[model samples]
Target chain A: MRELTYREALREAMAEEMERDERVFLMGEEVGHYNGAYKVSEGLLDRFGERRVVDTPIAETGFAGVGIGAAMVGLRPIIEFMTWNFSLCAYDQLVNNAAKLRYMSGGQITLPIVFRGPGGAAHQLAAQHSQAVESLYAYVPGLKVIAPSTPADAKGLLKTAIRDENPVIFIEGEVLYGHKGPVQDEEYQIPLGRGEVKRTGQDVTIVAWSKMVHAALDAATELAKEGIELEVIDPRTLRPLDDRMIFDSVKKTNRCIIVEEGWPFAGLGAEIAYRIMKEGFDYLDAPVVRVTGEDVPMPYAKNLEHEVFPGVEKVVRAVRDVLYS
Target chain B: MDKTLMLSLYRDMIRIRRFEEEAARSYSRGKIGGFLHLYNGQEAVAVGAMSAVEPTDYIVATYRDHGHYLARVGDMNAAMAELFGKADGCAKGRGGSMHYFDVAKRFMGGHAIVGGHVPIAAGIAFASKYRGEPDVTLCFFGEGTANMGAFHEGLSLAALWKLPVIFICENNLYSMGTPLYRTLSVEDVAVRAKGYPMAQEIVNGDDVLEVREVIRHAAKRARTESLPILIEAKTYRFRGHSMSDPAKYRTKEEVKEWMERDPIRLLAERIYALGIANEEQLKAVDEAAKQEVAGAVRFADESPSPDTATLFDDIYYEPEHHEQDEKVVPLEKRRQQASV
Candidate 1:
């Protein structure tokens, strides 16, 4: 095993997949010659040639839909939107065509495509660029929404997403691109719809995903000093949620807290809380608490941005609230 | 053109007209549900263009797809059953009329959203080129779709990639009652292609022969160069935009004028004048098409609706290998297993 940064892992995944299949290609704004806005696709143009690693114009809806069509025709297309903010322009293509084509075509067409870009708050980026859409896309019927917190998970999951016969939304956090983790140098796939418990404990279950997973893990480490053992669970895939695993975790822990980096209204945390209440309510010792971003647009100021996003402190508070009150 | 080929186009157009008439009736009688976009007045465009396309070539069309469906596949019964929402339909009743698909015929779909199929058509063409297949993708949409942002993106990408796609625009004067002239600054839809550097042709959609000639040349160009082409078929829709439209936007006199230039009649006259078919033979073709429509209606009426038990099936590809590996570790016990 070797340590790889999230951006390096992403580039590795693209490089490996493109090498494995001639049909696998990268296309996005600045993905080819410019090496990606976030440098996730750096050096791919040199290795895979200009035809495969394509640099697209600033046209999200058109290129995104074209990727879907190409996928339908038997070429695997990895579409990179610069950020989740820009994906809004191509939302119709993502939701209407990419997600629904397989189902609407009665399963005749397989949309083996991945729409990837940075998601959620990246310090002081402000309202237009900082919204999280993991929960929004997960609510749709025909899509796989993935937001991995670790570098190893990002590489493995992206490889799987490119090979998947259905459409997958690969969400990356801008802040976590430089974070490093140990990844095996062998071919592998982490199956979608499985949860990984990062830290095990007995007092509470902290269900989180993406950046919140890291926050929850940090909160667990701090709570350990106080003798409050908190279990932190990361659901990499949101659409095909591991509900049974979640229910079982809640039943064991007896109390639960959900941490999310999105707004409280109709957020992923709300869904988690609802699921725990509906399925494992009798096993709960207290109400399931949610630690989530404030229900307001992220501000440009660093202090205000910190106030908007959930952190270790918020997760720790939520854990104590669920356990005691 | 060969006599057989000319008669085949005429027969397909007649079949589509009769099938759509039945579909419209079925829809009005509460047999079909959801949006029913009729291609009543735009038969010549589909008939003529589809005539030039190889059977293996791909075709993608908009929600107003009944005419395109018939012209492409010549499967009247399935089209009618689809409109009737029967389980035996082309999409197995899941797609209904607005989303008809025939994979074997390479007829991609009846896309609901305006200009939505443009990208898909490009994709199919890209795949064809990737696999070294000489087939082309004929993408059909109305003049109204030209004004959409998707149209610009789809066409631009198709041209930039040099994908073998023929973007067929049926300028039916209106996009569901919003007249094209009112919405688009450039009334001529073909003028939009000036920006893309792709081969473009404008033809009389009222004349099936002219459409045939334009598409034939475009198809040849696409097959040889792998270059995308745009064909703007100047046509009109005789009926209201949908089954529900009162058609208050246009006068009865205008409707009468378009009706006089009916695509089917134009093809019929051309065929008769060329001595391809006598009056008696043309009458037989009309009778046979009517019978085919009646049979399709009967098939749809006799077929059953989809069972609720399987409503969620085919929605996602079934996970073929669901048996978890016996060596998989549970989250709570993963550390213990690792230590062991």
Candidate 2:
């Protein structure tokens, strides 16, 4: 295994997919010439050429729709949103067009396009710049939502997303791009909707995804010092959730603490909590606790920003509460 | 133009008018529900522009899309049945009046959200360009939709990528109850094309010949040069925005003024003036259009309602390729484990 940064893994996935399929192409603002806003698509323009690695104007809805239309006509377009927060400008195209086209057209059209970009609170990027919109897209029936927490998962999940026939909302961790992780030299794909139990334990089940998965793992390590073993699970795909994994983990641990960077109300964790309660009601020793970002919009102040989103401290507290309640 | 072409345009415009009239009647009788935006005075914009494009070209229309659908040779019975909420409708009754779709004809859809379909139209054009196909997409929207962010986004992308798309803005002067002038800063929608740096033209929407000539050139340019164009067809609606509209926004004099330039009447007059058809032949065309509409109504009345058993079908295309991994337990297995 060779170590690669999350950014490099993403570029490799895209470049490999483009070489394999002529229909596959990348288009977004600053994707070409400028390399990429985040340099995730670096050197792709020169390799794939300007036509395949297109640089689009700062029109999210326009290019998003263009990707959808191209997918309808048999082109697999990878549309990048500089960040998921900017995706709100193209929300209509994502929810109204890309999400509903298949159902509205009676399945005559398949929008095999990936709307991917960095998401969630990163550093001190204020309210507009920091938003975790996975719950919003996952709510739609026609969309497949995936969040990759590591370089290997990023590469594998992205490849699967580009090949999938349904519209995929690939939300990447803005903070994890620089994190180095082991990535296979050969090509491989991680199936969507399969949860991976990163660490096996017995006292409590800690569920998270994307950047929060690392936080949960850290929380488990901290709780381990106190002689409490926490099983950490990363649900790579959110929409077609791996209920069996979550339920089985909860059934064994009999207590669960869910963590995410999205807002508390109606968030992905909320749905997971509901599903766990509905199915594992009798197995629970205590109520399932949720550690989530504050309901208010993200603030700019460093201290307040850190307080707004969940971290290892919040996850640890939630686990303690669930275990001791 | 050839006599046959002139007569055919006249016939298509008449067919749209009569079809809309029948739709209005059906709405009045409570046979059609939801919003029914009739395309009465704007028939020439659809008929004329659609006639210029090849059969393979795509069409993306707004809620008021009956004319666009019929102009692209969409099935009359299916269109009427869709309005009637029958299973035989174009969208299988799932999409009422505002969401007619026919994949076989390459008529993309009838999007109800104002200005929402503009980007999708650009996407269709991008797809065609990506495949090296000569297909051009005609996207129709109202003057009101011109002020939307999507209109700007869509047009900018179309021009930036030089995608083969013709943005046809049917400036009927009113967006629902609000006048176009109130919403848009510019009097002519074509002026906005300067922002996108795309070629644009304003055409007499009531004159079929002028619209056809302009759209023909625009479509040809899109295919040969990969250039997108904006055509603001100055037109008006004869009736209210929808079945529920009281139309108190404008005066009767204003409606009457536009009615004087009615597209169907203008085409009929042109047919007669060019000696393409006599009064008897024009009368025969009108009669035949009325009969065709009557037959559509009959077919809709005979069609059955959609089967409730398959309500969830077509929500997603589940091919064999999407088979679940063996490692991932199914929902039923999870439920069984929970019971234990």
Best by lDDT: 2
Q: Measured with DockQ on alpha carbons, how good is candidate 2? A: 0.62
lDDT of 2 by residue, B189-240 (tens): 9999998799999999998889999999999999999999999999999889
Best candidate, DockQ:
2
Measured against the true structure, the TM-scores of the candidates, in listed sequence, are 0.95, 0.95
Q: What is the DockQ of each candidate?
A: 0.46, 0.62
Q: Candidate 1, residue B158: CA error in Å?
A: 1.5
Score residue B220 of candidate 2 by CA lDDT.
94
What RMSD does each model have against the real structure?
Answer: 4.9, 3.4
- Write candidate 1's Cα lDDT for B1-340 as tens digits: 5899888887888888888788778888999898877888888899999888899899998988888888888788888887777787888788887898887788888898887778778778877876789999999999889888888988998888899999999999998888877898996889889898787889999888889889998999899999998889988887889888989999889899999999888878888888989889988998999998888889888888865444555555546522332334354453322111
Tens-digit per-residue lDDT, A35-70, candidate 2: 999999999999989889999888888888888888
In model 1, which runs have C-alpha deviations exceeding 4 angstroms?
Answer: B321-340
Candidate 2 collision pairs = A66-B123, A69-B123
